[model samples]
Target: MNTVLRLATAACLAVSGYLHAQLYVGGYRVIPLIGPSFLVQASAAFAVAVLVALGGPFLLRLAAAALAAGALAGFVLSRTTGLFGFSEQGFQPAPEALLSVLAEAAVLVLVAVTLYRVRRGTRTVRA
Candidate 1:
């Protein structure tokens, strides 16, 4: 179960990384701070995905969770208030935005389940 959760979470992160990288190359590269941020996000997501896929410890899961949550927050801000002085209407750039959101959300859910499993494993019954 733990292995499955790790792989699923890793896959989610990888999908998000791929989407962001594609967006960066597809012209977001000219968007100043936002451009660099996307690149960093892609890199981090890929790295964490690799670690998680390799059965890394809980710390790696924590990092993956953080990365996914951060991406989702950025997505929301970019659409709502603004992110790096940039705002966009409903999931612009076709399906990538929507896909990325779904992938990040999945990562969060998978990580949450992983957390529960780990916590449950560490619990001890009364004598």
Candidate 2:
């Protein structure tokens, strides 16, 4: 993938990760011990952005995909747990939960597009 697109994708993932981390501090059930885990995962996204900015296109795509998948799983787990937290007041998803899911989905798409572009570029150069 081109540098611009890769960097943009990484940036988006970073922002999403940070937003997801916010969930833990806003009257949620997150344990104090879980904070570091969330921070590390979120920081990984930002780290990938920095890595891509430093010209790690090949590695950035893979890293973004892995991060996106991990975020998706985390969000799903959150959603399931949310069910237990629900009551007759109607199911209220944690703040930014939906947005986080959407952002992860977008990152997944970006990863796929980047992979396809890289593969196409390679094939064109080879031919």
Candidate 3:
């Protein structure tokens, strides 16, 4: 179960990274601010994916959690209130956006679970 969850988390991170990297092609024009932000996001996602695949150190898991939180916040702000003067087309669902959101959400859940398990294990060991 642990291995499966780890693999799943890594897969989700990879998918999320790809989606973020894709924004460079045409997404930058739609939201210029996204250019640098997306690049950073993609890089972080891939890095965290690697870390998760390797069985996560505490620092790595913490970084992954931060990245996931930032991504989620960016998605919500961009879609709703708009970020840096850039707003999505509308409230209607877009396939690509939905997929990205789902991938990020999955990463968030998986990473959280991994962190919880790690903390629990530490407590057991210390006790």
Candidate 4:
């Protein structure tokens, strides 16, 4: 279970890092409250990195779960916002919104599954 969690955490970080790096190139601004100049791609990457760096038995599970949820939301918003015909900025979804949504959905599933397993293990321990 720990191995799976570590793998999932690493995967999420990698995915987020890739996405963030793209945003940096694209010049997309980060969502407000998180950071002004912070890009979505960078934020996701940072979160994943933090989790992996802070891997402790006590908080690793919670951090992993939060990162998974954050990734899921980021993916969803990135996809759905463009469905309404938003202007194409440097970081905007290209071609179509559906593609972004689909991509995000896939990422979400991968992260979610890993988080779910971690959660289940925690629950089993508690019980």
Highest lDDT scorer: 1
What is the full ranking by lDDT, best candidate first?
A: 1, 3, 2, 4
Choose the strongest candidate by TM-score: 1
Candidate 1: Cα lDDT at 112:
91
lDDT of 3 at 67: 77
Prediction 3 TM-score vs. true? 0.81
| Global lDDT of each candidate | 0.92, 0.68, 0.76, 0.51
Error of 4 at 52 (Å): 2.4
Give TM per candidate. Answer: 0.95, 0.75, 0.81, 0.48
Give lDDT tens digits, candidate 3, residues 5-99: 78788888778777778765545635667778888898888988898889876566567667777887888898788898866754223565777
In model 1, the Cα lDDT at residue 42 comes to 97
lDDT by residue (tens digit), candidate 4, 1-127: 6555455555655555555456545554443432222265456556655666566463554554555455456555545674224223443455323343343454456556766776798899999
Let me know the TM-score candidate 2 reaches against the reference structure.
0.75
Per-residue lDDT of candidate 2, residues 1-127 (tens digit):
3766777777778777777567545544255444555677777877886786677857776787788788677556555663334321222354466676677787788878878887898999999
10 residues in a row with least lDDT, candidate 3: 87-96
Query: For every model in order, what is the number of clashing pairs?
Result: 0, 0, 0, 1
